[model samples]
Structure formats: C-alpha cells, structure tokens
Target: MKYYKLGIVALSSSLVLGGIAPIAYAETSIPTNVLAAKTTTSEVMDKERLIERVHELFPGMFEDVREEEFRFDSGRSYGEESELESYGLRFFKELSSDMYVSGRFSFVGENLELVYYSYNNENNEEALFPPQVSKEDAEKIAVSFLNRMTNGSDYQLADNDDELYFYDNQTLTEPVEYNFRFDKVVNDVPVPDQSIRIEVLGSGVVSYYFNELTGKQEVFEKKESLLTESEALDRLKEASNVELQYQIQYERSDDVKAVLTYLPSPKIDGIHGMTGQYYIAGELLDKLPKKEKLKVLSSTPVEKTASITKKEAKEMAEQLLMPKNDFVKLNIEGVNERENYRGQRVYDVEFMYETRNGGSGSSIEIDVDTGELIDYRGGFDERFLGEEDSSRPLAYKNALNKAVDYVEKYASSYVHEVAYPNESDNRQNRYDSDDEEYRFYFPRVKDGTIVNGNGIRVSIAGDGELLGFSIDFDQISDWPSLSEVVSKEEALKDYKDVLQTELQYVSNNNQNEYQANHYKLIYTGEMDKEVLRKYYDAQTGEWTAASSRYDSGKQPSDVTIEHPWAEEELNFMIQAGIIEVENPETFNPDAVITKGDALKVLSKSLSRYYRYERYDYEEQKRQTFKNIDTDHDLYGMIELAIDRGVLEADTENFPLDETITREELAVWYGRILKLTNVADHYEIYKLNMKDSEQVEKANVGYVALVGALEIMTPNEDGYYLPDEEVTLAQLALSNMRLAQEMAEMDIDYR
Candidate 1:
C-alpha cells in the first residue's frame, strides 16, 4: 500500500436536503439581443451586465450561503433526525479562534433539545454530556482541550509512519469545502498535491474518494483498510462501543473551508453490534492537474432512466445496495435520504435478512454507491467431499467443531465468525497467482459485532492446509480468494491434458485413481522437499496437507501425474531461483510451460547479473517468437537475449514449449562466453577421447561445457548423461546464481 498501485477511489453521498425552490428572476435591463446595439466597450459596464444576467436567472439566491431561508455565515451546522419532522439544529458562536459556542436547538413544539455535538474530538465523537455544559462551555472547552486526552498514549504517526508522531491536537473549523487534496511520499511524507477529499476523517483517513485519473469511485474503503476476518471484526467492535474521532492535518488556505465528511459512525443492536460508518463519494476529474475533489454534482433525473418503470429502477438500486450472495435474502424500503444520481432523491434504505449458513450471518454488505460484489456468507455451506459421492454439501460436524475450537484457543478475542465446511478449489493450473484454495472466512470481534475482514484459511475436508492466515491491520480485508479470476475446472483440465500425454502416470496425493478436483490447487514448486521443508521451517504458512504420506488419502477427482523431469539445467534453475519444480511430490511433465513463466525466468536471470546500457526495443523483441510479442512485457527482454545471440532458436523461431537441459545450456553458453574470452573453454576437451566412459560420445559440446563450469562429475551410475530434460527448479537455481553474480538491484518499479 506504499504507493497503493491498486488505487481504490470511491464516490460518496453529500446531504443536499429537500425539494428545489422555484428560481427567482427579475427584468430591469434589456435582453442580450437588444444590448447588441451598444458600441461601448467598458469593462465596468460589462461586470454590471453580467450581474444583471445572473439575477435574471436566479435572483435573490445569494452566493454567500445556501439553505432554505437560512444563512450560512459561519460554515457550521449540527443536528440529525431519527425520523421525519423530527428535526433539530445546533448553532454556534466563536468561543475562541480554535473553538465555537453552539446550542442544541430542536423544535419539539417549543425549544426542546438534546445536548449533542458537544465538546470532544474524534474517538470521543459520541461523548455526550449533561445539560450544564451549554453550547458556549462545550465550544469553549473543546477549543482549549488537548488532544493527548483523546488519542492513545503511544500514539504513532499513521502518516510518515517511521516517525513517532500522533495527534497532539487539532481543531476543525465548521464543515468546509476544499477544492483539492494533498498527498504524502515514500515515508508518508506530507506532500501538497491535487486530490479531492470526499470527506476527511480525523488526520489519516478519507471516507470516500475517486482517482482523478481513472474516474472510479470506491467508497468506505480507507487506505490499506484490508485486514483478516479477525482484524476486521476487532476494529468493528471497538468502533461500535465508543464514539469514533478523527482530524484533518494538511494545510489549507483561508479561502477554503475544511469540511471533513468522513467520520466512522458506530451503531448497535440489542446484544450484537456492527460499528463501521463508511462513505460513498462522487467521481474525480481527469489528469489531476490540480489538488482537488471532483467539482461536478448531479441533481438531474435521468430522462432515459425515468422512462423505465419506477419499480424496476427501485429494484435495481435495491439489489445494487446489497452484496450479491445467494445465501442471504434482503427486503429493502427506500427513504428520501437527500439527493440522487440523475434526477431522483437517493433513498435511505432499510433492510433485514437471515443467514442460511446457521452462523451469525453478518450484514448483506454491498458497495456504497455502485453496489458491487464484495463478500458474503449465509444460506449455503460447502466442504470437500468425494468427487463421485451421491451426497454433497454434507454436514461434517466434528471437523467444524475442531476448527472453531482451534481458533477460539489462539484467537477468541479477535475471532469474527467461523465458517463450517468451507469450500476450496485450486486454479493455479490456469492462472497461477489467482489460485484460490479455501472458502473459509473468519470474523474480527469488534464492539461485539463479528464482522468479516481478514483471517487464515484452511481446507478441513482433507488433511491439507492451503495457507496459514494473516491480514492487513485495518478495517479493510485482503483479496484472499481468486475464484473469480481463474476458472478452477479449466485449470485442472489443462493439468489433466498435459499429464495425459506423458507415459503411464500415477496421481499420488489421493489413493489409487483419485480425480482432478481432489488435487487441491497448489504451486507447482511446493513438491520439492527442500522448498517444502523451508516453507514449514520458516513457518511461512499453515502446515496441513491432503495426506501426510501422499499415498494413503482418498478422493474422487480425476488427475493424471507424471514423474519429475531429469534435466540438470532445469533442476539447477529450480534450485537457484528461476522456477518451481513441483506442487507436491508429483510433477505433471507434459504440461506446457506458459509463455509468461518462460520469459519470467530468462528475464529474471539477466536482470540479476547485468544492467544493459539501454533496454532493448520493447516492441521489436515481442516479434521474435511467432507465439509471443512485445505487447507482452517479456518481449523486449527475450528479444535482447536473442539479438545478442545469447539465446538459441530453431531457424526462424524460438520453440517456447521445449524443455531445456544443463549441458545444452552450457554448450550454448560456451559459444557466447567465448566471444569475450581470450582462449576457448572448449580447448581442454578432445572429441571421443572420453575421460569417463559414461560421458556420451555424441556430446563433445557437453564435454566442453563440463570443462568450462567444472561443477558436476560422474555419479554412482558413472554417467554425466547430458541429454536428460531439465526441471524448473534446476533452471531456477542456476539463474539465481547468475543473478547473484550480476548483483542487480532488487527494487521494483511497481
């Protein structure tokens, strides 16, 4: 989140209350057509004429303040309603430059009121006081109050994080409108740049926002808000229990009003509670030439949209307002909130539902503005079972019980909600990084509300643990499941097809003849004992597998496996760092290495060792392979190797699928290395005059390779037998060494 390449901009709501008043017009001057007769070019006269024109359009509608018969001189107002006609207002007088004196005024038939918006900063937002502290004392006391009383004792900078600074104190002028936003740098160093503030909450968070560049508004999502299911609930609970507080720290000019629209509102139900008041904002402008929020506001009722039956539009908005999960149902009744998108008023929707999953079904959450899919739980429960079993979604009680017990022991206080019989699928065979394994979701206990945010995921249906869990430590959740991106069935199909072409193979994870779905998606490299050992030793993730012995488990999915390749170069790459060799003990040999992965290895190899004076042509290199191109990032680097004659290709093309071996690579390297060498490394070798009978007579080139590197030798079988195909791991290890020798920088542009 340092640079937040995955910028989540959002749109939010603003309170523009009520029906439009008729615009007033006056006619004291002649029309523009009549004015055309004037020959005078007086600047002062022009200004007068413009004023007249404006008055003719919206006369008496003062530009100074906008409210129905109400003046906005001080830029502040406070009051809220629980229902219609239940209105109240709070007015304030300047108590000091830093504070204002305000009174809670309500019209409950005559001056009846409640003391709210009293003296207190965020974290104390809900701090209510007795009637004694009049609007005067509240505003006066607030101005003199120190922030140390409110912020945490060990307050650390959310901005410029390494620097230990916290909210020592801050004062908010009435809600003000700012034209732009500012940004912070590498260490969260504050930098004044163009950014629109939908609403600023406290010092470090914005309620809603839109990237000026992309025009996408992502609401309620604060910077780095992602967290584990556990962390998410924990935050929500705390927020609900107490009134939240925040401040705006950036510098703004006197002409600009600093209105912070974002304040996380915490609500509570009888025993359980959910406490996250997020925001939805409008879209931003193009190309951030200035630091500011979007200027356009929509009040128009769409003509086309209006043409649709109001019922249909209402239904669209209702569904959009809720998360799309089949397990939960929703009943929405829209209220006249404030303003709408086209020409209608945005509805204040009231809803309720039941979680069919039988657990504490949380809210049917949806995106604030454009209701889009986020997360869901209810109605349905799933777990791994035999592929051909007649029964499905079976209720496995014992396993669910154990998992909850395990979680409660290590993480009861922060635990959100535990899913029973979570579903899992492996999709690495199609989209590697998008591989999702488990469907288990956990919640964070916040203010008693078990809200889902972030957590660890494991597949209990089998012995395997897809991953131990962790989450970003904030209100947001991480993108744990890639089920949507890579099609699981498709990836497995690809895996089956590749391995089927190989000689007779055995699918080892499950008992004899297990099906493909039972494989439980895994990284191709996870099979290596060294890598697996390291994975567990480092405690990098949770340690569970479908079967510990790999020979006794039972499942019904169809899967075909082939033995690992024997190529030394490939094996070296795996060891050195260029590629992964196995997902488990099995290696599906016939599987075609992806064009993306192939270039990744080669580019990674070159990237480690050398920095070219210039990057080779990006466009041209992609043209080197018939099956690949420069449009792909690998294009330039691959072409660079080819043009330098450092790569070997058949006549006109580089066959991307063929496996490479050590001897072949070494032989190839011998020629390239000699271009700068004073004497040929091949000089020490004599054709057919074998040093060891195991050396193939047909491999004089390999003999020369062995002499040049001097790393390997004849083994117990007495063979340097050079023609064997290389494994991905071997290729990785060699490339890693090459990279180390080159000593390239590891910083990434992204």
Candidate 2:
C-alpha cells in the first residue's frame, strides 16, 4: 500500500513516534536562534495546549504523528516581527499504511483554534455498505457536536435541497454520509458568508468539519434607522426596468421566442433601507449613471464555411498569443476537434508556456467552419517573469480599448453579431486587487432585441494585455414574432405583484471575508420561494417558472398515500425525477400508460445519459425512427432505448402512443437482461401455468425468463395475462424489481 500526502505543505521535520517535535512549526512561524531564545518557553506551552485539544477531539487516533509546515498569510502586517508568536499549524497521523487523519489549526490571539479537520477513511471496506445509522440519527449527532463550538449559538441550520444523504439512483455499494451546513446569524439576520459545514459518516462519526468564521471585528448598519418595508419596495420599483429579449426555451424545444422580462438590473443589487439609496456592490449610490449601448464593430457579413486549414489555425493562434519576453515561448502541445456548449464544431488548440517551473498553460478554441476565434485566454503571471516590477497599471478605459482592439483583430468575422461593452460591464469587485482583471460582456442582438443565452465575454489584465475571450452563439433560425407580445408595463406589473422581500444582513461586494467586511440590512426577494422567482411570459400573458428537471411541491399527490400496493414505488419514481407528475393533485396511478411514456421512464431510470444533459454533438442530430424526429418531445429518450438494445427500430414508424401489453414489457425486460438470443428461440422454453396457452409462441421464452427472475410475477391465481394492458402502477412496481435484480446480477445498465 502507498501512503499519500493530502495537502500542499512543506516537509521540514521527520516523523515523531509519540508526540510532535519541538521545532515543528508552520513556515510563517519559523524562529531564528535569536528569536527562539526569547520566545521558546511561551511557544512550547502553546503547542502543547493545541496538541491536547486535538487529542480531545479525536481520541486515540493521532498518537504517532508528523508535522507539515504551511504558510497562512492573511495579507495583514504586524508592527514588528517579534510581536506575533505564530500563525498556523498542521499535524497528521497514519492510522494505517494507506489511511490517515489530519487537523489544521490557526493561532487566534493567545489560543489555537481548529480551522479544518478530516478523516481519510473514504476507501475503507467497513464504510462501503450497510450503513449502521440512519440519516436522521446522523443529523442529530452532527447538531450535537456543533453545539460544543465557540460560536455555536449564533448559527442556524441552512435550508437547502443539498441535505439529502442518499439519492434514489445511488448504488448500494457506495458509502453513506450526511452533509449539513449551518449559517451564522447576527441578531437573527442571516449572514451569507459566515458558515460552518460538517459531514457525518454512516457510523455516526463526524468525519469532516470546516468553518469560514473570521476573527476580525465588523460594523453593521443600524436597523433602528431603517425605512418601512413598503418604502423599500417603492424604491426598488422605481429603479427596476423591463426589457424585451429573445430567450431560448431549451426545456420545451430548441425554439427562440420573444419575451418581455423584468430581469434584475446589474447596476443595482439591493436597496439600503436606512438611507433609501441603491446598493451597488455594498456601496451606496444615490442614482445610477445613464445606460449606454455598444455600437456594432463591423457592418459586413462573413461566410460561415470551412475556409482555413488546420496548419493555418495553429499559425493564427501563435501569432495572436506569442509572449513578449523572448526567453518564455509558447509551445504548441496539440490540436483536437470537439463540439462546444452551443453544439458548434470547433478546433481546440492547447499550448503551454515554457517557463522555469514548466506547468502553467492555457488553451484557445477557434471555429473550424468560419475560422473565427471562438475562445482564447492567455496572460503572463507575475511569477512567470522571474521578477516583479513596481509599474502602475492601466486605467479601466484604456484596458477596455485594448480588449476591443484584440477582439477586432482576431474575431472581426463574427464581431458584427455582438453589441459592444459599456461602462457598467466592468467587474472591478469580482477579482483580487493584486491580480485584478476587467471582464466585459457583449450581448448578441436579434431584431433589435438582446439574446439572453448568447453573448461574448472579454477579460483584460491590469497591464493592458488580453487575458481571455469567448463567444456563445447558437444557430437559431426561427424566432417568435415580437409584434404580438404584451407591453413592457404589463410585464413589470405582473412581476411586482408576485414579488416579496425579507430583510437580511449581506456582505459588502459579496466578499467572503466576513470578519473584516462591512454589512448592510436590505430588503430583497426570498430566493427560496419558487413562486416569487418566475418571469411573466409576454406572448402567453402568463407567469412561467424557470426550467428545471423537477419543480418544487411536485411530489406524488395525497391519493398515493392510500394506495394498496404501489404506494412506495410510485413515490420513489416521482421523487427520483424519472416520472414527471403533470397534476400532483390528480395523479391517477391506475391510468393506462402509453408506449412512449413507459419507454421514457425506463430509459431515464437505467441510463445516466438520458437523465443528464448531453453535449455529444453527433448524438444531437441522430434519429432512430421516422416518426420520432429531432423536434419530437421523446426523441432523445427513444434514441437512448434503441442504443441500449432495450428497443429496436425494426419498423419505419413506431407506435409511440399505443398502449403497451404485459407481453411487450416482458420482452423489454428480457432484452435488458441480455437474454435476447434465448428469448428469440421460443421453442426451447415451456410454460406451466393456468393460462399458459394465452402466452404467444414468439414470447414464450421472454415470459419464462421474467417469471423465473421474478422481475414481473403472474397474478394471484397464477394466470399470466400477457394480453392485458399494463397500468402506470403495475409498470412502476415491475421496473423497481427489475432494477434490484440487475444490481444483484452485477449488471450495470448505466
């Protein structure tokens, strides 16, 4: 067995048998001979106290340990070096040759506090199956352990959908663990940045824990001087504006439609209730500057065809991304063709910077057909230059101009389709001050309306050099008519009617440094409420929720609770997102299911590709049946079934809407089990049942296999009703049984 080092820490001292070595310390706390003489007694006592704390947390697990030296620079300077005793410390112990436990602690004033802890028992055989504790019990253990922390009383359990310990599709061989997040609140107002995350294993052990709580003091806005809720809403309404745009409805179909939406303005994030001013990145602004539109870079159209060779594309990349320093050269690694997110074929050129360390590299993507620069991100890090210069950085306006110039030089053929950037597009607060890079987004325009899903993003470094560029344009031919849409006023009114707000303490500029940052009390929409998060559909004059695989409150109806047989299986399928419930109140499980609906559920439950989004460009255009075109609702699922050999396109047009029979289901199950050859030879199998003659001769082997495997059983009277129509409930129960048998047989359909 090979032992692995877990973190990026320097090895300074040898492994100690009983306890940590006296000289073992973090790099930031390294002491010279003179400094050691002055602080030896105090430092030794602090180290002993921290070691005792670790032993108390994980008793008897870390006796034989080694110290790893790491640097923790908070970017704050103390007056003198002798004033600060230590900064951070890390220690690990080998439980076995291949398993270990580690803990990281930081010095807070006079005491050492644990910042992170982990137990590397992920591959242990004992943790793989048959979880000893339930998720509810594990959650209780987590909460009990959290209450012993220093700031435990200030935190509350976070309400999110990520708290599930196991998913329906998860295999039984995978380890079971519960994850919980607790958010720190100030005077009952939740702070988004300060939180603690804890992971509890199946054995009810706290396996990992990390906290983002800071030590620095902070100032918060006074709530006593705030305005009323109605007053804040009025200010938000005054600042909000509606715009007409083209939104691609990918969930329904690949169709672009004109929509009048009231999207939250990028200039304003929230309203400050204290002063009735707009909050833009935590700064109060009396009013926003006038919005400006970007002018088209070119007026001429370019041909969309393969005009350049592979060698020419490589040459273009070298010409555009060549470094300024002669010693550092751009080495072309290789080139490959792949489909981008928008289903466009492009050539990805990967290259590396031949620097001293020999690891930093980036890639550039170009359109193979039009030979346009689709994506490129190249810049020189300060460390790569072997020296640092104290030169001043370029102004924001100068950097913007440099970015525009680079785009025009490399992507002029496609630049005419995108609108140019304005002043508000500058993302100054999103990056660090030392490595600040300005990003600008230019939206694509269609018939004078912006395309929400299509845009071009450009990033320029502080030294006026191109850092990154990418274009996201889809080939859409049909667009809805804009003349018949509702007015912008009506759309805005509809949004305001459903909008609701709650007060919370938010960090300035959305920074994660909670202790050193300032916060303000603001009224904003509750993100957890789905009804308040929808947009008004201008064409239909109705509100439509965001596209998701499953909607909130879309569980099986109350009628399922009284189900005599398939209550659990029906609820499981619905919760797993395999079966969509159109009407949660009236989900009649007894209704007969069509061939298309049955195939959809089976394909999604067995194949991982059908459940998730596929970016394979070739599969996007392929069709298996004549009736199930690319535009059909069940095209992808049907194709997945055909590919998996569960169904075949033996006929030109499949009867998608026809009701399925019991014999048909058995045939599908037999194919899934890879017994097709045996099932095809029906003459070799004999059926012994009351209605044995009712089974077709061609389906005798299929029915025999399903009955023997217990995937689908006969009726109470031992009568095989092969010609009866299968109901939704009957399919649900049988599919689950088939899945269990597949797992037992070690057959991985996914």
lDDT score of residue 568 within candidate 1: 38
C-alpha lDDT of residue 338 in model 1: 30
Q: Highest TM-score: which candidate? A: 2
How accurate locally is residue 730 in candidate 1, as Cα lDDT from 0 to 100?
Answer: 46
lDDT for each residue of candidate 1 in 364-471, tens digit (9 for 90 to 100):
222233322122222212221112323333243543444454444333333333222222111100112112222333433222222222233323322222222222
Which digits, one per residue and each the tens of the lDDT, describe model 2 over residues 90-165? Answer: 5545454433445444433454444455554423444433456777888888788778654457888886453431
What is the TM-score of each predicted model, taking all chains together? 0.25, 0.73
Best by lDDT: 2
Which ten-residue region of model 2 has the weakest summed lDDT? 6-15
Q: Give the TM-score of candidate 1.
A: 0.25
Candidate lDDT values, in order: 0.29, 0.63
lDDT of 1 at 231: 42
